[model samples]
Target chain A: MNFDFTDDQQAIKRTAHDFLADRLKPDKRRELAEAGSYDDGFWNEIAELGWPGIFIEEDHGGQGLGAVELVILQEELGYALAPTPFFSNAAAGFLIQQAGSDEQKERWLPGIASGEARGTVGVVSNGEAVLVPDADSAAVIVLVDGESASAVEAGSAEVESRDTIDSTRRFSRVSANGGGEQLGGDVQAGLDRAEIALAAELVGISQWALETAVAYAKERKQFDRPIGAYQAVAHRCAQMMLETEGARSAVYYAGWTADNEPDTTPLAASMAKAYAADAGWRVTASSLQVHGGIGFTWEHDLHFFLKRARTDGHLLGSARSHRDRVAELAGLSRAAATA
Target chain B: MDLTLSPQEQAFRDELREWLEKNNPGQEPSGEQDMFKFRREWQKTLHDAGYAGLSWPKEYGGRGATLIEQAIFNEEMARQKAPGLANVLGLVMGGPVVIAHGTPEQKERFLTPILSAEEIWCQGFSEPESGSDLASLKTRAVKSNGGWNITGQKVWTTYAHEAKWCMLVARTDPDAPKHKGLTYFLMDMEQEGVQVRPLVQITGESEFNEIFMEDAYVPDENVVGEPGQGWNVAITTLMNERAGLAFGSAVAVKLALGDLMDLVRERGLEEDPIIRQRVGQLYIEAETLRLNAYRGLTSQMKHGIPGPEGSLPKWQWSDINQALTELAMDIRGPEAPTVDERWTYRFLRARANSIEGGTTEILKNIIAERVLGLPRMR
Candidate 1:
């Protein structure tokens, strides 16, 4: 079995990489983060590129691609640490496409797919959805609570803007008292695919952090030699590689499983999410450690990656929560608990 | 990227599956000699079916299977819980090394017996003083009338007592550099000066042995490669040991994890949050190990050599296996230290997983220095 990407997939990856490199340059990201707002014009350019609808069906006015293609774009965006509403928008699209009824699809899929009407997703807790990313800008917001999901119009929900440690993206707190229509299909399937997307983003963050750390280790000198000459520093970088690669493999496999083997998606996606959430935070923190004093400062771009990784680790679901899901899906069946 | 087998690969797998279903040799009996004999006969059955040395070249009496087929064979064997062949070292390392480096005479005399398990092989690379730093091994050999006379001590030599030949590396020149002076020799183990003493490990099992060679005879024809080239030859065998073996080990860990879940259910400990979390962590680690191995295989196929991550699967396997056993023991709780047979033996055996093939420290060093381009610690 070959794990290497196909020619088409490789072309998508290369195009995304070069495009993000030019569009999401470090200065642009820093400029947006400092302004505490993303460039709406630049986001329209991304939407025009059809990234938000990369996984949507052709019947729904979008590219009839799969989760693998969506993951490739998300990974590049994560690597650039771009200040955009891509993930939030994609999360809403996934839930609607996977769980929406015929009427629901007809009503919202076209707008969401064409990027004319952006959407966001948040987990509902006690009738309030916290950390609903880009909710202020999204037209439709899907709030999931347990097995059921509801789609609320932004005006109908109490969308209070909230700022987090990660300035790379905006978030909001939303409250809806049965304000929106309930989705009638399998919400868990949609959530699992969403988790795989998040895992892929984490893989990208970890890769970036690891490359930054390794490059730093080779140049930073201590006691008349590169710090990398010492096993302590070298081994730290090595461990980062292990974690990053593990996350990457898991994410890639999960993405493929979501597209090709829906039955295996829950377990594979949980494993990917759990492993990558931990890896993302750990590798970014380790890179910060390798950079020493400079990494801790706001002047360096490393802090942005570290903050985004930590925030992403807690987004959608924490690593511990997904790990518990892994426990259940991976043969420690819930039936055993009751028995 | 396709994770499923192609039509040809599926056909190959189905054929092998049918053969195994009909000719499966169940399990081995208890006694050491009986077990060895049972495995030897099993190897003969496999050899007759063209499964033994499945990856060896057709010129060397092999099926000339592709690397993916070899991986499938390994995975299927592990998945079926099939008995291991007696001449594992011969089929995996020794025979491959001979095919890669041996003379025509050596190939003619060695390949067939190894496949049929008529002549079992054991490696003699690790000495008492040369574990990780193998180049420092001081096993000396001097030229005699027609061959070399070798004197050395080799530890952790599995199957030393039963092996007919030892893939021995020895110093041929004392004055040369540590890495340059060595030679690779296929030493006959039946000579007068050779002795094998079983080393009982922590599990109270004699799975490995220490061999003392006081001028053991090695005729000139037994040398696999030329003199002053043992390091390179030994490295080839070591690389073979690491490559293509990960798929098998990953499957084995997965099987153990399944057993662990069964135990968790049986003991009604599945509801315990701590045990569930531990099991979940182990599951993630195990799946990641499997995925990483597939990625590594892809890189190897593309580059014609394993990439830096090739050092990874073994390290991940050791960690995941150890954690799985530890969690099983924790679930056992008060019964952890008791002689519960399977779990206890596994828990203790897993302690050597990290130390056996290569230490975790050495693996990290390899990754840091070779893979990441870090300066050497020294």
Candidate 2:
């Protein structure tokens, strides 16, 4: 009957938050961003620490936590923009764990939890062009063509990740041939799980962005006023703060519903994903807007959140798209999740 | 989200549900029935049976249970489609105000009967002059003797006809700040100078009233709080009022759906995509509202009594209701132009759903400025 965290869940969240904050080095983040690549050593450390595997079975080379735990761990990682293909891999791993057959889980689960296998769900691509994140970094790409699942390996990097607005987390287009196995499972199932997870990720990203913006507003002063003291800046940031919190609660409940097997769960995912995309986009835009002139500059890292947020909004699906799916689930029948 | 009730909360809900079922007189066949009176006696029964004031302090003769238990009580009552209570103002608004800011005497004198429906309460804030611009209210309460002499006109005072007491807000010092110079009082609606005029609505019913006060005497002891701090006390009532009990709104839409579908089948339009699409849209809108309700409920459980995010659900609900009823009217065709007791009446009546509590435009502004972080009007 816990709509939220038990004390044990809260404690795990606290530990995870503290662990990442304590372990992440600003210098390391700078090194990875500057190099325009991930630090494999950092990836190994994350895997060995079992942060990414919080929900993966221990036998699958991971920790055996749950959906809630994954949400907490991703939150900390997102706070730091720790250069890892986490949102992708964890989302993919959890989706497979929920909907995949034993053959499918055996094929990719261990590698993903062990950090040896990197995974990302590719929703729309023609192999000629792609808008997926970290396609270059990913080892196995879970591709969805509306309602089917397949693994496409990006063997040749013909597609390029153009100059992106978000400098911190990288996004790229994918064009690969001689690809991988086309697995079988419910594509919407994977999409729904990924949708719920992405919504939760947006919650993390939105919160960090709002908190950072608020802190920045307080610390950065103008006209002898903590710009936050000015109703103009303060209220906008306040809305961002509120929307972030509201979206977080919605996303958490979606995750909670997934964990609990509630009677009507698709609406939870739809509501979360729709709200996450809508709120993530808004808060990120507000974040950039609040930073003003400096925020407009490339030198300001504030643009990082904006880029990732915009990309995440459309990653699995946009809010409108998810909402339409919600309409289908809620209006028509509950066969989508089961189907 | 694991929203199952605890054993005791479940038991409490079972008991409440059982009682409501035995007593529940599904809405009367006649539109002109006295629901308020029926509901009042029922509430008195609840009070006597010890189910009222679930989260209030025991000092106020409440059960003094946890907020979760109160929430369970609300959800259960809402689910059962129980008769609306006449003491809503007393239970949801005035009692909370009295408990929080009322003197010990006020609590002892007001709380017990209010819960028992012995004294129905009505709010007096929205006036002919002030609505959303509430701080600009001109209701005047002049200092006189050991108390005050009030003279004001208040509109949209819901259920004032049935109420014996009114929660009044008046300007104590208009010369002070717009919000600061106010006083809140417990007014006697039956006083010599207090008059309540029915405000007829599109529903063709005086669901609320416009009350005029000329030299209405209110003793100092009846003041909800310090004289000039009335706005603060008023806000306490408003906040609790907004903490929310909106659930199962889909039921009304469900009734509408049943009626509409009967009409659809009668018109032989079941196969029509146009008709189907309208029903589908209405169904989806109703479903979306429910999902939004769940979203709000889940948040309330996590974050406590909903912040301004509460504005989002109310705003969305109004939109859905307006859109649904409008579409239903369109589906009813030229017959919609004709008003009757069937779907036409409901369509006409549901229009007020957007106006009551708050207007849709005002709600959107709240969503934009409060929830969406748009700039406030300068």
Candidate 3:
């Protein structure tokens, strides 16, 4: 059976990519990132492009597409390094659509799609990683507790800046103080959705990192040969390709699980998110090495990708956490068997 | 981005899965003769079912389906524990080359029977003198009349005794550079001077054969390409050989895993955390392979042929197999030293998996030199 992007899907993905390319320039990305102006304007741009709406219903001013569209959107954002609230708002907006009441969606979903409001989900009460399109600037924060969730307004929370390897994501420590509206149902399900979304984001980042590395390797020459012509570098690029591919597969399985197999989504997301986190870090590291010394400098374009990779490497859950999650799933199965 | 199948493809997958769910080649008796008959019959059945030539054009009696369909067929085939394909030389190499590089007459002569399973073709490579140094082989196919006289020994020929044809590579020029002198030929294995003797392997079965030739004759019509350009032609065959689906881990597939588990369980060793951990480790390796397969599939779906990234899975798989077998054999305790134990059978089989398609060392070299951009060792 065919396991490929449909023509319509491809067309939409092309449109999103073109939209990103047309709207964001390299200088603007640099300027915004420098100012740390991760804000509502960029969020508005993506929301206006109907990205946040892809998972939302048509009546809620959304596109009503599924996990496939979500992937296309994240990949485009990654391609641009757009410094937008796309990842933050879209993912949180998706959660709202999932567990929020009809009244909750009616009140916030439209504002999210229209850029009047933005949101993000923090499965970890406190995390040090900065690995999304933009996280610190979101207006609303969805926090998960076991199988339950609470939506805390960012402006109301007492926050502390955390030590971070990646500056682009700009994460913070927050004290929710039990001061928020709880999401519907158990906290574990909500945490699963949030983790899976982060995994999808990492998949996009890893893919983009691999492509950039390959292109860079092909262009940068040494000793009368393109670095890519050398097996050490070429194999790094190849391994990056392999990891990106692997991440993509894992993300897809997780994405599919997210939409259909919600009960198994946690296990699948753990696998996907864990693999993506590790792979993204690897591809980014390999890209930097392939770039050589120039990649280490902030002036070079390579650090930008590397920074995001470093940020995302520990976001949502680190590779170890996801591995533990997998172990937990296995543990559950064994215990259930004995019972 | 989307993973859903079209109605037709879904129907095809369902039909194919239903077919595979019932038919299994592993059920064939382990005897080489019995296996050969089973293989021929299975190929015929696949042909009759229009499942042959999965990626070939329809006129060649193939299904002429998309690459994914071919992938599905291969995946399902592997899943069903089918025998290694009977028509690989034809289906994977011959069919592709004939379509891309073959003469019209060659296609007309070879295409149908290949899909029909009428002729089982074996690969003639890996001479005793030229294992990793295949380019330096001295297999000479000298021009005598309108044809050629091939004088060489081809060792490690898989089932050549049962095969009707051989895809042979020989040195057409003794004076040229090592790679420059090579030529590719699709020769009749049943011809005079062609002697195929099955080598009783360490497994106590002669599954593969060695061919000895003394001035064996081949008509000019069978020549794959220009006489001096055989090296280039041979590269095409090698490239085709290098290309195939990634199985990731030998222990990953459910049946394979189950069988491995049964071995551990039958030995009453299930309580061993080390055994459980080893199984878990094998599963992760398999999952890694599965991830690589998906990545390659995603690339193919969204971009193009997955390229060298596809090779990493197999390379890692073989390395892990060698390790896994060593571990399994270790767990089997003292009974594993010789062929006295079933685990040793797996150890031997694992050894062959690396050597057969490509050796672990060569694959590592390829990954390093070609994929990684590392300098090659002299």
* DockQ each: 0.81, 0.16, 0.19
DockQ of 3: 0.19
Interface RMSD of structure candidate 3 (Å): 5.2
Give the clash count for model 2. 0
Q: B229-283 in candidate 1: lDDT tens per residue?
A: 9889989998888886899999999999999999999898877888888889988
Computed on alpha carbons, the lDDT of every model, listed in order, comes to 0.90, 0.71, 0.70
Instruction: Report the C-alpha lDDT of model 3 over A1-339, residue by residue, as the tens digit.
Output: 234566887898789878777777777777777766665666666666777778778888877777667766776677577676666777677778778888877877886766667777665444322233334566777766545667777676555655455555666666577777877744565455566666666776777777777777777878877776666676566567767766766676667666666776777777777777888788888878877888888777667767776676666667766665564453323343334
Could you tell me every candidate's TM-score relative to the true structure? 0.98, 0.80, 0.82
Stronger candidate by lDDT (2 vs 3): 2
Q: What is the TM-score of chain A in candidate 2?
A: 0.86
For every candidate in turn, the CA RMSD to the true structure comes to 1.3, 5.3, 4.8
Candidate 1's docking class is high
Q: Is the docking of candidate 2 incorrect, acceptable, medium or high quality?
A: incorrect
Off by over 4 Å in 2: A11-36, A79-82, A99-107, A124-132, A144-190, A208-243, A286-296, A333-339, B28-33, B58-61, B132-136, B142-147, B171-181, B202-204, B226-229, B246-378
Docking class of 3: incorrect
True contacts kept of each: 0.81, 0.16, 0.22
